[model samples]
Target: MRAQPTAKSARCTACRIPSRRVHGFYWRSLGDVACFGRPILLLIRIRRFRCTIPECPRRTFAETLPGVARLPARQTDRLRSVHRAIGLALSGNPGARHAATLGVPISRSTLLHRVCSSDADPIPPVRVLSVDDWAWLKGSSYGTILCDLERRRVIDLLPDRSADLWRRG
Candidate 1:
């Protein structure tokens, strides 16, 4: 099923700008919401709008739904949630296996890529921190990761796991 284009113009949640010029519309397949022990696929028609203000930094902005973001191929917010959960709960193969049950089709390598590609950085004034090392290519290459001990999330990844690197960081 597809959603119909309504008279309503969705406003940008980030910048609070109302846009009327829709670039295009596309259907996104979202996760199933449970109903009577059955899975229901949510077919959401999301709009890609042209930014009304030329002065705005972004030329085009997608209208965000309640839980989804723009430009991602996956339509389900559950996928992202599962990815994040897997990333935090377990590392390597185990995490990917766990994520599979949550309807996210990610491999171990994909999980690692997601972790390394993450742009989130912990804000400072962090009291306790954890430093650990992971082999990127099994003995050939290694990287050190810094984490916020309190938050239990990775802060940064360094190329080498060395005392000099830690000292410089």
Candidate 2:
């Protein structure tokens, strides 16, 4: 299906100035919800508005449907949600297999990337420390492991397992 947006003016993202002049329009085909077990496509006629500010470097900007999809995105917002869920539920190969069965054709690498690309909470500084060592090549190279007793996780790994190395760290 095809549809033209009704928004005549849009605010400039760079300078925050409202633009009313219509430079041109472009057709963007987006993947929408499935219809009767088939993927439905939505073609939106997006308008490019000329920036009113003279100092702004951007000459024109395209209108956006905030809740629908992000700029330069091919899939719908809901489809991204589905991808995230599938990506998190199962790792790469298994996720891709399940996604294909569910009618969403996504690559195994893409699923793995999606799951690992999310912003993670920062780990705070550790107070109590636990030091240990393990051989790397077992008779060749050795490494030191520093763990936070409170957090119960490895804080850092040193190249050489020694008292001097542990003291320096």
Which candidate should be chosen as best, given TM-score against the real structure? Answer: 2
CA lDDT of each prediction against the hidden true structure: 0.66, 0.79
- The C-alpha RMSD in Å for every predicted model, in order, reads 8.4, 7.3
Q: How well does model 2 score by local distance difference test?
A: 0.79
The digit string of per-residue lDDT tens for model 1 on 46-116 reads 78788777677776666666544434544345555556567767977889876665555577986776566
Cα error, candidate 1, residue 22 (Å)? 4.9
- How many clashes does each candidate structure show, in the order listed? 0, 0
Residue 43 local lDDT, model 1: 78
For candidate 1, the lDDT comes to 0.66
Model 1 scores a TM of 0.46
Error of 1 at 24 (Å): 4.5
Tens digits of per-residue lDDT, candidate 2, 101-138, equal 77776799977765675432247888999888767888
- TM-scores for the candidates: 0.46, 0.61
Lowest summed lDDT across 10 adjacent residues in model 1 is found at 31-40
